[model samples]
Target chain A: MTMTRIEVSKTYKLFINGAFPRTESGRSWPITGKAGDTFAHLCLASRKDLRDAIEAARAAQPKWQAATAYNRGQILYRMAEMMEGKRDELAQAISAVPNGPLAPARTKSAKRPASRTSSLRLSVSPSLSPAAEVSAAIDRLVYYAGWCDKYAQVLGCHNPVAGPYYNFTVPEATGVVAAVAPDQLPLLGLISLLAPALVPGNSTVVIASNTNPVPAAVLGEVFATSDLPAGVVNILTGKRDELLPHLAPHRDIDAIFAAGLSASEAQMLREGVAENLKRVQIHDVAAIAAGEQGQSLEHIRGGVEFKTIWHPALA
Target chain B: MTWRSPTVDTVMVGERAASFTKRSIKNATKRELLTLALSMLDLTTLEGKDSPEKVRGLCHKAMRPFERDEQMLGVRLPSCGAVCVYPSLVPTCVEALGTSRKVNIASVATGFPSGQYPLEIRLQDVRDAVNAGADEIDMVISRGQFLAGKFDEVAEEIRAVKRACQREDGSYAHLKVILETGELETLDNVRLASDIAIQAMDDVTPSGTGDGNIDFIKTSTGKVQPAATMAVTLVMLESIRDWYLKTGKLVGMKPAGGIRSAKQAVHYLVMVHEVMGPLHAGPGGSNPWLTPHYFRFGASTLCNDILRQLVRLKTGKYVAGYDFSEA
Candidate 1:
C-alpha cells in the first residue's frame, strides 16, 4: 500500500527493509556536490536506520525467495529496459565517462585490462561539470546493466557435488547488502551497487556518497518510478561510522560493504560479517585505480544465500 | 611569545595576520598547522593518535604526577581525552591509568607508515586492536597503489576497515583512516583524499571516496619526517568544513606526527580553534573520544617542556630542566 508523506524541513528517511523513517540519532547534514553547484540536505542515519534496515531485510526475504529465480532475472532485465528508455531524461543516472586529455591514452590502453591494482586517486578538477560526471555515471551503470545476464554465466562456475543433488551453482546475488558509497561519485558508484544486486534478485541499502548524495536521492526517485519492487533497494545518506554498525551483523543482513575504508575500517566489516558468516569484500584502491575489476568483485563476495536441496529415488 | 628557531619556519603568518587571527594560535608555524586554528573556514576535529607503546608510557609518566595533589607541573589542561598507543599495550594503559578518569586508547593498524600487507592481515590487525581494548583505531592506506591512481582499490580497502569494528556500541572501536598527505602529492590529490575520507567517514560513495571515514582525517604517520603538516591541515580543515556546512553533519579532524612540544600542541589547538571554531568539538577529555578528544599531538617528548614552563610560572624564577625519568 502506498503511504502518506510526512511533513518535515527536509527528507532523509531511513531506507530500512524498504520504508523511510527518520534516524533515531536525529542528525542531518548538508551535502555539496555536482561541481559545487548544488546542495542536497541529507540525514545522517542514526541507530534507527540500522534497525530499520534489519526489519526491512526480514520483511523482504520471503518474497525475494518465493519469486522464481528466472522471474528475478527477468525483473533485472526489465530494469535495464527501463533504464534504456529513460536514458535521455535520466542523463544524470546513466552519465557517460568523460573524454578528456587522458582519453587518448585510455583509448589506446583500453586494449590492456589486466594491469591494474589498489590505491587512492586524488585528482581535483574545478572544470568537472555536474552534467559531465553524471553522464559518465549513466554510461557506467548501463554497462553494468548489460552485464547482468551475462556476468554470472561468465564469472560463476558449475559446482560438482559428490551426490546426485542436481547441484550447479550460478553466481547468486548477495542479499540485503548495506553499502557506503564514495564521497565524489554519488550517482555513479551508488548506482553501481543498486543495479548489480537488484538485477540478481537481492535488495540493497546504500549510504549515499556524502558529497554527491543529491543524485543518489534523485536516483531513488527513478527507482520508485521504475516499477522496482518495494524492498528491492533502500538508501540512507548518513554518517558511515554511525549507521554502519547498526547494519553490520544485523540478524537480517547477509553481508556488509564499505567504500574507501582504512585498515581499521576494513577490519570492522570483516569482524562484523564474521559474526553471522556474512561475506565481506574490501576494495583495494591500487587495484581499483588500475581498474582491472571494479566493485563487481565485492558484489560477488558481499554475501549470497544458496539453497541446497535433496531427493530420494525409492519410488 | 616570539618562539622561533634557526632550523624551521614555524609561523609564516606574522603580527599583521596574527592580529586578524588570535593569540591562542601563536607558535603555530612549526608545520604551518595554526591555519586550522584561526578560522571557521573548515570542519575540523581534534585528533590524538597513539601507536608505539612508548608514547602512551610517556603520557602516563607525565600525567600521573600532576593528578596527585602534591608538588608537580602547573599545567591546567587535563591529559588528552584518549591516550593513543599501540593495540598491544591498551590493556596495560587502561589498567595503569585506572578507571577513575576515562582516557581512551587509540591503536594504529594496516601496516601503518607504509601500507604494505595482505588484506587478510590488515583486517586481522584491526580486530586484534579491538580485542586488546583499543577504544579507537588508526590505519594507513596503501600509498603505492594510490600514487599509481588506483581509486577503486583505495575505496574498497577503506570500506572494509570500517566494517570490521562491530560491537554493541555499533563501533567495536572508533576508526580513523590516515591519508598521509605528504605522499598524496598535490593540493588536488589532498582535496580528493579529503573528499574520499569525508564520504567514507559518513559512509557515502563519494566522488573521491573516503568521505570522513575511519573517524579522523589524519595528516601522516610520524615515521614520515615532515609528518602530518599544516599544509595538509589547511586542506583537510577546508574540506571537512566545506562538507559540514553543506551537510550540517559535523566531522572530526586530527593532524599527527612531527609534534614535539606543548607549545606545538597549543598551536594545533589554536589552529583548530580558528578554523572550525569551538562548535567543532565537544568538551576535551570529558568526551569519550580519548586524548586529543578534539585535538591531539602525537608526541614522544612534550612532557619535559610542559613541566619546565609550569615550574617557571609557579616559582616566579627560572628553573633548570630536571630529568623527569628519575623524578
Candidate 2:
C-alpha cells in the first residue's frame, strides 16, 4: 500500500479538444522513455488538432446520438471499471517489452536496473492489459453493446407488409468516423480504433500514433474524464501523413478508418479515398497485430435505416 | 550462282552477324516451343516453407511495385534475381531489392539440385553466402559424379564452390554451375556442362575459385523442371559466344528455370537476340553490369505477376486478389 513514483511527464502539452494546448504547429518534439524519464518538449498536433477534432466531432454529434442504448451500455460497462482502477499507470504506459515484467516489482527490479532501460517494463501481464487493453476494448464494445438489442434480429431482412404497414432491417449510424491509430499499441491501438466508431453511435476523428503522441494525449485525458457524450471519441495526436489527407478527403467524413497501409500503402488508401465514394476500410495493420480487434466492427455501417414510423390511420 | 544479291542494307547487313546459321539455331518455332512451354505459367516454385518471414514476405511482394487483390494469386514475375534464401535471408535479399535493380542473391550449395553435400557442407553453403550477403553461388554438379561419368568429380566440386567464394573482402560471388539440366541429358551433355561452366570463368589460379567465379552458366536449379532451356540457352549462348571469340573475354549467360513472365521476359529477350547477334543480346547492348549477369527469371510467381502488373497500372483499381491473407 505504498504508491509514490511521480515525475508524471514534465509539463508535456498536446491534448487538443479536452485542452492541453501549445502545439498549433510550433513544433516541440522528444518523449524518449525506457525510463531515462524523458518527455522533453512534446507538442506538435496542430491545424488545431484537426479543428479541435472536427469541432469535437461536430459537438458530440447529438449527444452521442441521445445516449441511451441502455445508457450506452452503462457508459461502456463503466469503461471496464475505469480500466480496473489504473493497472499500474496503464502498464507503465505501454512497455516495449523485455524482462522487466512478470512483476514482483518488475521481477525484483529486473535483477537490479541492469542497463539499457529494459524496454521500460510495460508488460502488465495478468494476461496483458492497459486496462486489459481497455478492458478487452470495452468488452469489445459491450459485445457491440449486446448487438444494440439483437443485431436487427439476425442481421436484417423482413418487409412485405405493403398494405397494413411495417418495414424492417435497421442498424444505422455510418457517419462521421475518421480513424488512423495503429502505431503499435499506443493506448491499445487507439482503443481498437475508438471502440468501433464510438460504440456504434458513430462520431469519431482519431488520428493518434505519430510514434505514440504522448500516449494519445493520455487518451484525450481518458475521454475527457468519461460520460463521453462530448465528441464521442475524437483523439487527434499528430501526423498520419499529416492527418490522413484531412480524414481521407473529408466532406464531413462519412467513413475511413485506414489502419496500417502497404500494398503500396493500401493503394494510397484507395487513392486517398476518391473524394466522396469515401467509405474505405483497409485496416489490416497486421490484422490489428493479430487479434483483429473485432475487425473494425463489421465495418460499422449502421448507416442504413427506413424507420417510417407514422401513425395516422383515421385513429 | 551467287548467294550475292546479299541484301541492300549492305545485302541484309553483309551476309551474317555471326552464329545465325544452323538455319538460325533451328529458329525455335513449335510456336516457339509453345511459348517456351508457357513459361510454365510464369513459374513460382518457392519450396519456401518455414518462413524467412514467409520468404521475405515473398520478397517484398516480389520486389516491390505492388498490388494483387484476387486472393494474392501472386504472379509478380520480374524479380529474376536474389531469392536463393536461407542464410537467415541475406538481409532479406538485401532489404528486398531495388538499388538500381540488381537482385541476384542465390546461395545454393553442393547439396542443392542433389549434388549431396559434404565438401565441408559445400564449403558451408559457400561460406554462408559470403557471410550473409550473397550475390550468387548455386552449386550442384555431383549428380553422383555427373551420373557416374565423374568429369573429374564434377570439376572438383566446381573447384570447391569456387573456393568458398573468395573473401578478404574483394567479395567475389557469381559462381552458379547447376548443370542438372535434368541430369545433363545430352545437347551432348549440354555442351559438356557448358564447357565446364565456361572453363570455370577463365581461371586466374591459386587453384582459382574467386575472381567472381564463373559469372554465368546456370542452366537449372528450379530443382529440375526441365532444368533451363532454349536448348540450354542455345548451348549456353554458344559457350558464351565461343568464349567471346576465343577469349576476348565476355562470359555471362544464365537461362534459369522455366523462365517466367512479362512474356517470359520478352521470350528470353527473343532468345538472346536469336542466339548471340545484336552484340550477343545479353540484357541488350554489350553489358550493363550484365543484367544480374545475363538474365535470370528463377520465378516465385514471376515476381508476383510483375508486381501485380505494376499495381493494375498504378491503382486504376481492379483488385481481384492473390494471397496476402492467410486469414
- How high is the DockQ of candidate 1? 0.00
How do the residues B1-327 of candidate 2 rate in per-residue lDDT, one tens digit apiece? 111111123232223322232232222242332323222221232455635566556555444323443334334333334556545566666766645544456766656667675788777867876777776776767766665766666666676677677776765677767677767655656666667656654552332332444466777777676766555566666666766666656666666666544345445555565555555433335532224444455555454334433343444332222322220
| Predicted complex 1: CAPRI docking category | incorrect
lDDT of 1 at B163: 70
Instruction: List the candidate 1 regions with Cα displacement exceeding 4 Å.
Output: A1-315, B1-56, B62-77, B204-214, B278-291
**Candidate 2 segments exceeding 4 Å error:** A1-86, A91-153, A156-178, A181-189, A192-212, A216-238, A241-243, A246-255, A258-271, A275-315, B1-140, B143-196, B200-216, B219-246, B253-293, B305-327
Residue B302 in candidate 2, Cα distance off native in Å: 5.2
lDDT of 1 at A288: 29
lDDT of 2 by residue, A75-149 (tens): 755654565465455555555322121222222322323342332322333334444554555456455555554
Assess each model's interface with DockQ, reporting 2 decimals per model.
0.00, 0.01
Q: What are the models' TM-scores?
A: 0.40, 0.34
RMSD of each: 25.7, 22.4
